[model samples]
Target: MSFIALHPLRTFSDTWRHRYLLAQLIKRDVLLRYRGAVFGVLWIFLSPLFMLAVFAFVFGNIFQSRWPEQTGGMPFWLLLYCGLIAFNIFAETVSRAPTSVRGYPSFVKKIIFPVHILPVVPVGVALVHGTFNFLVLLAALSWSGNFHAHALLFPLLLLPLLLLALGISWFVAAWGVYIKDMTQIVPMLVQMLMFVSPVFYPASAVPAALRPFYDYNPLGTVIESTRSAVTGQSIDWRAWGVALGFCMAACMLGYAFFQHSRDEFADAL
Candidate 1:
């Protein structure tokens, strides 16, 4: 049996053709998370606020953390939270990706389904939650008297990250069907990545030997650029441009890989 085309053009076409189906899937995924809870959809807003409070107490109160050469009047926790907004978009999407496809055996085996959209669903849900988190961040910044017009660029600044997260999600979702270990391993790696990234500290604080790696890391670059946008600091467009190019390439390659391996999914699942 012939498999789906591996060309990036075909992948894009499939996505656009099934956009409505993808939308319903994304909606279902979001609602399922809160379906039984008394808090319901409010958790989308409350969850991140609770996380922010925990981070603020642990880092701001206990460690007395501050960004290096911290120039903005923005509080340390808010600064930390700004970078975290970008990271969480990526982290939350990737953390759930492993099961995006594997968790849907009925979709694979019992129906003629466009399974490629399964991976995209997690990223879509993440963006929905991330948007709520961004709003919360904006409110917090306004309260702190550090709000800026540059914060409006926050969604644009996240484009590279969205592309990057989608690419990685597709790859891991496919691999997860074959390797149960991926479900466990991906989260740990995500946690490790959060620490290495400039979420808690400035990129300047990293040792000289590791600076190049941080600069080249697409996730780190996006987080830093996003932080700059929120803080009214100048974003490094050159670095962001490079990250965008790399992320586009990754998106294409990941789509190709997922399509190529998808023919085996019915048997595997």
Candidate 2:
């Protein structure tokens, strides 16, 4: 009898071993998204800018929203945008994970492929979008005079969320191969997460009784710390360290789950 190896180390090695293929896939994934559009790839740059304007107008002007403990009097939209950028990366990646494996039957049945890397493709694509959003955020921050030197740490701070997103992506992508309904269910959950997360509001605004739950939410912690990085507020390194630990463990577990389940994908599909 043959045995399948579930070693967590293979996750990194598999990804590294196929780095060129991954890059080509990611590039194709990105270009294919806007291939037929009139504006083409320009939409990538334009779409986020348009959304930022809408957010600024709706949140900053219409709603009259304000951060609970805002010290710099940063525009509410700017604060909201900071958190949204981080959340969007996770949300976008996970929402697409289910379809990632399900959409590519050829890869599973007709050819030899590293299906484990399929999940990472969504994270890479989302990061591409997130990168554009971050550039826009920096422009907004600079325009509003809220840019902080600490914001340089923004990418570093995103480590945990990136790991978390990749982990969830792997788990969902594998499950999506077996359970067709996951494609629908995962997006709905991502929508609910947006509300539960501190994206549009501050953690400080949560009621005291509920604060503990909010504090423990890894997404909330990342959002808060990310906001601090943007606005020059003090970051909770202790909390971030804890989140990083959790994310790393989750990433490994997710990779293990994906590898263990992949053997059945060809038959299931």
Candidate 2 ranges beyond 4 A from true positions: 1-9
What's the lDDT for candidate 2? 0.88
lDDT of 1: 0.88
List ranges where model 1 is wrong by over 4 Å.
1-9, 56-63
For all candidates in order, the CA lDDT equals: 0.88, 0.88
Clashing pairs in 2: none
Give a tens-digit lDDT track for model 2, residues 1-269: 11233344655787889989888999999999999999998888899899999988998789977787766568888888888899999999999999888899899885578888889999999999999999999888888887899998998999999989999998999999888899889999999999988998888888899999888888889999999888888999999999998888788888888878888888888
Model 2, position 33: C-alpha lDDT score: 97
Model 1, range 148-189, lDDT digits (tens) per residue? 999999999898899899989999999999999999999999
